[model samples]
Target: MNIEIVDIVNKINVILVEEFEVDEDVIEAGKNLKDTLDLDSLDYVDLVVIIESNFGVKLVESDFANVITFQDFYNLIERKILAKQQ
Candidate 1:
C-alpha cells in the first residue's frame, strides 16, 4: 500500500517517542508539537535530527518554524519527499 501523510506523521511520532523519550499517548492529530507535545527547544532540535535520519531529508529552520500541528509536520515531510523524488 502507498504511504499516506498520516503514515509520515506516525513515523515522526514514533521518533519522538523513541528518540526523545516522549510519551505516545499524549500525541494527537490536532496537537501542536511545541505546545501540546511538551517539546522544548532541545527536544525540537533532537526531533530535527530524528526527522533527517529517519526520512533521509534535511530539516531547515525556516521549514520547521511553520510546523504547528501533526498535519503540518506530515505535510513538510511529504513535500520534502516529493521534492527529492523529482
Candidate 2:
C-alpha cells in the first residue's frame, strides 16, 4: 500500500485523540510525544500495537528511541511502510 505522509499523520492524530485523549491542537509535528502527549512506556507499547494493527508495520524497540516528536513518528512510520513495500 502506498501511503502519504499526511495520511499517516492524520491517522496518528486520530489515534492519539481517540486512544490517548490528546487534544488535537497540541499534536503538532514538532511537539514532543512524551512532553506534549504524556506518552509513557506503556503508552509506547500501545502505540506500537496500534501502529502494527493499523499500518501493518512492526516497529522494533530501536525505532521508539528516535521518535521524540510527532514528525519523527511520522517519518518512522513512513520509513517502515516503505521498507515493507520493498
Candidate 3:
C-alpha cells in the first residue's frame, strides 16, 4: 500500500483540472484549494464524489475542516488511502 506523494499530487491535479475545471497553474502545494478552485458547497459534494470514485476512499465532512492548502488536501488523501489499507 505504499504510495508516493507525487502520485497523489498528480492524481489530484488531474481530478481538479478535469472534473472541477480548475486552472492547472493554480493547483500548487501551498495554494488554498477552495480559493484557487472557487468551489461552492455543491462543488464540494461533487469533489467528494469524484475523490471517492477515483481514490476509493470515503470522505466525511470533517475530513475537510483543516484542508486549506493543496498540500493539506494531498496529505489527507494520502492518509485516507493508507487508512483504507489498514
RMSD of each: 2.0, 0.8, 0.9
Ranking by lDDT: 3, 2, 1
Flag the better candidate by lDDT, 1 or 2.
2
* Winner by lDDT: 3
lDDT of 3 at 6: 92
Q: Local distance difference test, per candidate?
A: 0.80, 0.90, 0.92
lDDT string for model 1 (1-86, tens) is: 24577778778888878876778887887788678777778877878887888888888889987889877888889899778777
Clashing pairs in 1: none
List candidate 3 stretches off by more than 4 Å: none
Candidate 2 steric clashes: 0
Report the lDDT of model 2 for residue 14: 98
Please report the TM-score between candidate 3 and the true structure: 0.95
Estimate, for each residue in 1-86, the C-alpha lDDT of model 2 and write its tens digit.
68899999999899989999988999889988889988788998898999899999999899878888889999999999999999
The candidate with the higher lDDT, 1 or 3, is: 3
Alpha-carbon TM-score of each model against the true structure: 0.84, 0.95, 0.95
